[model samples]
Target: MDFRRTSTALTREQKLAVVSVADVKAQERITNSYEDALIGQYIEAAYDYLAGPDGWLGRCCLLEETFEAYIPNPGGGFELPIRPVVDLSSITGFEVSDGAGGYDPVSAALYAKSVNEGFGYILHSGQSSWPISIGVDPRRYKVTFKAGFGAADDVPSPIKLGIIMLASHFYQNREATFSDNRITAVSRQIEFGLRNLCGRYRISRDHS
Candidate 1:
């Protein structure tokens, strides 16, 4: 449905409509959902980087040895800083704990999540996984594919060329200037990566 475009000027109060707390929370959820999905993408990319041509699952444990701080989003939500575990050099004793405890799991988990989201930047050329073409300004393309997956309730990643075209906008912009395809593909990759991660999540396996 087309929203009516009103150019009429409104008072400051009218312009600044107060959003209810519920609405704010809902918006936060949506934003966080996207960010959470993005995190998955970073994880996949990092995992791929660590794994190379061979399967990624086997090398996940290496990250634990290099445990580091988690990096949060620019504003809020996540709260982990980026730091290699190697940089940490202040341990005085080496007692054996019941559980294989080394660096903080919570922080490491978050860091691993972020790296997964950074994968899109790595696989999106005209040759990697998808032969999807992207112009200098990819916002102009009309293809879509997901480099990762999000929550379990999340929808399936659209890998079809038709969906990719539609998502990228075979003809128009859905959200911003970034080709509709790019966003959709990016979203799909993130969702698929995370969704399929249950049995094969790199971080968990590595840490375990």
Candidate 2:
């Protein structure tokens, strides 16, 4: 093995680092299916919904903002973060719910609309890098509710399942025939951009 030669294989240090990150991500993807607890069932439902051509699991269908992540997805990178945009000015229905920390079924419904609006911002806004810049774009989420009973229960079991299943993709290892230079270049960019944000969250560019 020529250590100095720039072959397709990763160097010893590079491979180890990538493997470590990949392992952590893989653990997250593991679905606890012993008694079909919090994760297993949810993932199954997502797969079921995605079984058909119109399952609405692809990039355009469900996700509105997807560029840097999907455009040049990195190694051990399957778990994708999708943000949709919803216009506060247009939403005409129930009160808007903000799931900043967390959310239940009802909150998820309203938040989903808001996320779609963010997606629209990404699609049109060409000033920034891609999805992240757009997703972070300042937008308002409306909360409208009439004096009535607990908001309509649109939180179906199938939807929950899909969410779980969609998350599973993150654990799976990706195989690329030809490694692209962009992966390394993008990681460098990530490292540079996140230098200031490091103390808060651990961010590094170790794409092998």
What is the alpha-carbon lDDT of model 1 when measured against the actual structure?
0.26
Which tens-of-lDDT digit does each residue in 7-122 have in candidate 2?
23223333222122333335465334452232343343343343211234322122111122212211121222222223433222222123363212223322222323223211
Please provide TM-scores, in order, for all candidate models, with all chains considered together. Answer: 0.17, 0.18
Q: Model 2 Cα displacement at 8 (Å)?
A: 29
**What's the number of clashes in each of the models?**
38, 21
**Candidate 2 similarity to native, TM-score:** 0.18
For candidate 1, lDDT tens digit of each residue in 29-131? 4334444433333333333333311333322222212212212111122212111112112111111111223222122222112223222111122222222
Over 4 Å off, model 2: 1-34, 37-56, 60-83, 87-118, 122-158, 161-208
lDDT of each: 0.26, 0.27
Candidate 1: 10-residue stretch with minimal lDDT: 87-96
